[model samples]
Structure formats: structure tokens, C-alpha cells
Target: MVTLGVDGLVSGLDTTSIITNLMSVEAQPQTLLKSQLSATQAKATAYRTVNTRFDAIRSAAEALTSTSLAAARSASSTNSTVTASATSSAVDGSSVSFRVEQLATAKQVTSLEKWSSPTARADEQPKPVWPIKVLDSTGATVGSIVIPANATLTDAVSAINASGYGVHATIVQLAANQFRLQVSSDGTGTDGARTLQGADETADDPQSQTVGTAESGFQRSRDAVNAQISIDGTGYVRESSTNTFADLMTGVSVTVSKADPTATSPTTISVGVDGSAIAAKVKALVDAANGALGVIKGYTVSTAGSAVATLQGDRALVQLGDSVMDAVSSAIGGKSLSTLGLQLNKDGTLSFDSGKFTATLASDPTTVNRLLSGVPATTTDGVTTAAVPGFADKIAALAKAASNSSTGTLVQLANGRDTLANAIQDKIDGWDIRLANRKDTLTKQFTALETALSTIKNQASWLSSQINQLYNPNKSS
Candidate 1:
């Protein structure tokens, strides 16, 4: 019934220290569990790092398989007066010569009699007659504009713009008090020409009213004209409504900047393959593969005086590195990475030679394209047979298999490590609880022992005092 932890009070012994020492011996298994947990966590971290490198390589491989690489072309113009652009459909190494004769013109008209006051109040000005009819090139009515009775030249211009007949109207100031309403076609071409008719039908004498001519209100400035160009020679000429001629050449758009029909020389437009761009894409793939190789080597290789890497001797990581190297060394269409100027090093990494690759691309471009992008083969009966996959295709598949979240090798390994670490932590926690209970029980036992020892000592001291008194009976009363 003694209170707990009251140790060595009467017996003069360090019972608490003795109990702590015993518990420390019992905690050995818990310390081992903690060490195992730390190792498992480290392994998981290493796997995640490798997975990141795999993702980068996968992205690069995907880019190498794009269709744009096969259709890359560049076009250049010799003369500044002409510019051209080529698309994927353009034929490589093709050239064309052409001279721009004339540029398309838009129809523009200005007011013959300038309005005296441009900034005059709209309420005090006499507006032009309402319902100005708009006409096209064929003298057919297209639309009409109606202005308010007391509107200024600016107001009338705004009304004309809102008519929605493919005509734009603006008020141009000539002098301090001189202003005119200018109207022009919204497009360039003979078909885009516009004419305005403001004949006063409401007047009793309709013949006296005029509209489009200078006597009425507006005067013609420039008439719409078509564009003209001569191809190869002056005997063959082409005409268009706009300067941009897309039909003149297949997959090539020619934009004329100036008109010089009489010029002796014509602008030469040349379309050809863009070798530098294709080489850059190949370099990216090589770099990504090297990056993945470096990550794998960092974990697998060992150094003196340093702790072994977490992934050292790990079979999964070792196999992954081997697979990547094998893909590079394997042949596609009897052509390996060496043919493309990519060399496999002794350390399982890739080295790229830009100069050699560029030369190979220029000399045998078709073969290079076929090797990187595997060609499809068919049997004699026209039935599809086994198709050869490119090196990039093989690497992409390997990356996906190794990094997949659900069933990938690295992902599974990381998940297993996490599970084992959690289990070990649980065991460590259990040991903590058991040790605390043991310490409490030991403290209670020691407290009881101390109480009993104190009682026995008191009893012995009392008995000795009684015996002394008995022996000295008459010495002191």
C-alpha cells in the first residue's frame, strides 16, 4: 500500500538509477527498429529522385516523335520587295522567280465642296439631304445613309460610316474653316469600289439634284485596280485582287511589297530543308538520356570513406540503367545510334557530335529520317507485317514502364519501403508503452521495500532502549 517512486529513502540505495539502467537494456530492440525505419525512408527518397529523371527523358522522347520534324522547311527571298513563307506541304529545294508589276488599289472619294466650318455647332448647321444611296462597281444600289436635318459635317460622316455598305467615312480638315467628308472602300480590289448617290427625290425638280459628282458633294480620287505579276518571263502574267498570291505556288504564300514591272531582274524565292532545327531536336533527346544516366550512376556508384548510397546494390535501379543503355546500343533498321553521331560511353552515357550529325543530315537526310522514324513494311499480299520501332520509341516505352504510378518498378519499390517503415514505427511505439508500464511497476515495488525496511529499523531501536533501562534499574529513578 506504499506510494509509488518513494525509493531508497530509508535503505540509502539509488533504486531509481538501477531501474533506469535495466530499462535501457530492454530498449535495444526499439533502437534497432528506429534505425531500420531511417534506412527505409532514405531508400524511398532515392527512388523518387530516379523517377523525376525518368519523367524528363520521357518528355524528350515524345518531342522527337513529332510529325513536324519530317516536314520542316525554310523559305528565303532574294529581293526585299518580295517576301515568302513555306508550309509543310512545300517541296524542298524548289525555287521560283517572279516580278511584281502592280499593287491592288482601293477606291477613294472626297467631298468636292469643302464644308466652310468643321467645328460649327451641329444644331445650327444645314445638314445634307437625307437618304444618300450607296452604289457598287456595277451602278447597283447596295445601301443608303440618312442624316438628321440639323447635323454638322462630322455628324454626317458618322451617319455614313454606320450605313454598313463596306464603306468608311471620315471628316478631313483642309483649312481653318474648310472640311470635307472622305469616303473609301474597306477592301483593296476592283470589286470593292464604292459610289454614292445623293439625288434629291423630294425636290419638285429632281434633275437639278446631283449626288456623287463634284457638282453635288463628292469627287472621285482613286479608282480600284487589280494586282499584276509576271512569273519566270513577261510572256506569262497573273492578275489578282490583292497583293497576297497563295495560288501562284503550292504550299508557298507570296506577299508583294512593291511594284516594279520594268525591273530587269526578278526576286528568287528558294525553299529548302532546315537542317539546324532538326539537329537541335536530336540534341535534346541525347541530353535527356544523359541526364537520366547521371541520376542512376549517382546512386549506384560508391566512393571511399562515404556511406553506401541508399540505392546501391538495388536490383530494380540497376536493371533500369541497363535497359536505357541497351536501348541506345540496339539497332533500328540496321542503323544504330552510332550512325547518327551518338556514341555510347563506357559509363553507360551518350555523347553527341554536332558537326558529324549535321554533315550526315545534309548528305543522307532521307536515311536519317527513316532510321529515327521507323518505316512501315508490308507483305507481298498487301497485308501488314511487323513494323520496326525507332530508338526513341523504345526509350519512351521503357520510361513509362519504370515510372508508372500504379504498377511501375520504382513506384512499387517506394510504396513497399513506406509500408515497411510504417510497420517498424508501430513496433517502436508499442515498445515505448511497454517500457513505461514496466518502470511504473518497478517504482511501486521499490517504494514498498523501503517502507518495510524503515519499520524494522524503528522496532530494533525501541527494543534496545528498553533493554538498557532494564539493566540499569536502580541507577536512575
Candidate 2:
């Protein structure tokens, strides 16, 4: 329907205002839908907010379960370049010193002869040559690179690199137009060494490329050498193919980046128990638990002031907060959470006593660890016992179940609310079209009424004039 531009042409009434007021009443349903959409969107956002805190709790709990946290050893080296890491198996308060004998190196060789151009020329034209055979130290063929059509130094480099046989080839330009082929093993030590060989004196044949020549034809630039370090004040020495020496001590990984054979300086490594670091992890768990609980409380509880609790009347969300608190306050192995410096406050939030935790950890670390991580149930002779979930593990399980991406309860709740909000928005959008059409129809009806009124007024005026003329036709003055 089209709208009439005229507003009450003869009725002398404000038709546009009337139509607007009528449309306002007609849009009651849409008004209600808009309210519903806002509330539903808020609910979705609140659910995700709670889920975010729950995810944080899950991460902190998982950190507690890690071996890295349990072992909690700190290692340092006197030399700044060398780095060492200690695993759970490493003994606390252990120290070791070692002298760097030499660093690991790869086997490298260069072409004995220089070439005028990178590409080979036969009969004054580019030609193909035999492939460069890469033989291991034991003379076993490990890799081979064939010369491409119109072979050039770039071709050889690409072929050797793409072969993926753990070797790198480069064309070294000693000077402009004086290029030589340089090949090196990608790996260090004797085990990674390879010997390059080409056709033996086949210059007259089609394979006349003397670039990567036969064995003994190339200059041995560098030999594959292993990394060696001597134990301080002891004759015992260790060697590794790579820069890392993982077995020098139990649970200790040592990596040497620099070595000075003639220097008397020795790198001293000390591994010590990191009690403070472990305590910090427990504190993080407590903080995360408190954070999740606070979010839950804010959403579920109403206050004296006028902040609306979006989820105040929700029963499930209330239960979620209660479950998290229970997970924190519950006992493990008949031991209260205070044993780990975790205490529940009156306001339903968790508090961490770091000093108490550190003391407990120092007194009995093994038992403390068990309380954080649950004990698996043992079965014998058809008898089964339930496993006891420890504090961290239990909280982790609950939070994970509530915050997991695919199946978390809170995740699904938020997703469901979002779906509902989307549907409500669709209804609201539909009203925009309906209201426009209704206004057009109302305006057209008023325009038609004005046209009919104008015709009636003209007819009435004509009738009065004709009656007067008939009554006084001969009495004109």
C-alpha cells in the first residue's frame, strides 16, 4: 500500500499524528519482543562470563596436576650462555660443574676447483651431468641429486636441499665469476657425516660437470665433531652428537651454546627445590576458585542497591556456585583443605594462607602432593574400591565439566540463550515490515475518505444555487 501525502485535506484533523498513535498501539507485540531480546542477550552474556571464570579455575587445577609443578626444581648455570633444566627425577640440592671441551660441528666440504660459470657447458652449450652421490661415512649411498636440464649451480643447490637427506648445499662465490660448490651435513658429529662423489674422470662423457667431484677431489673444509665436556675435578667426560647433553645427571638437561677449549672457566649448575614456586601454584588455584565463586554470587544474588541480577532467579546457576564451594571445602583423605592453606571464608569465597601451605609442604611434601592429586583405587579378587579424588583433581573435574567447549553445562546454557535471542530478534525484525504496511493502508483509507467528502460538498452547493435560480427566474432586479 502507498501512503497519501495529504494529511486530512478536508477533515481538518491531524491524520499523521493519529496514524502514528494507532501504529504505536499496533506495535505492542514488537515492543514486548524487543524487551525479551534485551533480557535474553544479557542472559547469554552472563552465562559466558561465568564460563570464563570457570575456565580459569580449570587451568589452575590442571597446573597442579602437572609433573612440572610437582617436581618444581630450579636450575641455574654460572655461564650466561648455557641453560639447564631439571625434571621431576632430579634430586634437589644437587650441584655439578663441567668444563666445555668443544662444541659440536658438522662435516663440510668444498669443490677443489673453481668454475667459470655456475652452469655446465658442453660443445659450447648447456648440458646435463651425472648426479652427485652422497655416501655416508660407511660408503653407503644415503642421498643422490641428479643434474637438471641446463644444469646450473642453482639447480644443484635446489636438488640437494629438496632431497631432505639432512644435507645443505650452497654455491660459494670466492670472487665474482669464481664460484665453488660447498656441501655440509645438516647434523653434527661423525654419525651425520657424508662424503660427496661424482663420476670418476668422465670429462669426455655427457656428464662432464666437475662441480661436485669424486671423493678425494673436494677439499675437506670441516670435519663432523661431537660436543665434549669434561667433568670438573674428575677424569669422567661426556660427549654428544648435538649441543644438548641430557644424561649428565638424573632429570637434568644441559645445553651448551658456546665452548672455549683453552679457557679454564667451568660452568657450574645447581638444582634446588622450588618451594615458593610450588606454593604460588596453590595460591593461583585458590584465587581462581575465588574468582569463579564471586562471579557466580554476583549473578545469583540480589543486593540492596539497584543493580539487577540477571540470573538471580535461576536455580541451576545457584546450584553451580554451591557445587564449586563444595569442591573447595570438601575433605580429601580425611584431611581438611587447611592442610594445604586453603580455607573457606564466611562470604563463600576462598582464602589462601601461603605461609601455612609452605610449612605443610616442607613438613610432608609427599602427603601434600597426594592430597592435591587423587589416589587411584586398587582392586583384588573381584573387589573394587572407589578412587579418592584429591582437591585439585576434583575441582578440575567439576570446572572442566562445566566449562568444556563442547559439552560444558554453562557453555550449552549460553549457546541455548543465544539461539533464543536470535529467534526473538527475527520476530522483532519481522515487525518492521508489518508496521510499515499497516501505516500505508491507514493513510490510503483517510485519503479516500477526503476525496468522497469533497464531492458531496460540491453537489450540495450546486443544488442550493439551482433552487434559488428557479424560484426567482422572472423577478431579477
Please report the candidate that would top lDDT against the real structure. 2
- Candidate 1, residue 104: the lDDT equals 91
TM-score of each: 0.63, 0.66
Candidate 1 lDDT tens digits, 145-255: 876766677777787788799799887888877777788988777777776766553212236653433115556788788888888754688777778878466688888
Query: What is candidate 1's local distance difference test score?
Result: 0.78
Q: What global local distance difference test value does model 2 have?
A: 0.81
Tens digits of per-residue lDDT, candidate 2, 1-477, equal 767687877778788899899999999999999999999999999999999999999999988884755578877789987899888788888989988888899999887666667674311222223566777755567877776566667677778889887789888889877877788998898878877766442221225533333555568899999999988889788999889998578888899998866666778999876778888998888888888888887888889876879898688778888887887778888888888888888988888888988888878887788788877787989898888888888899989999999999999999999999999999999999999889989888888888888888889899998998889868667
Report every candidate's CA lDDT.
Answer: 0.78, 0.81
Count steric clashes of candidate 1: 0
Of candidate 2, the 10-residue stretch with the lowest lDDT total is 120-129
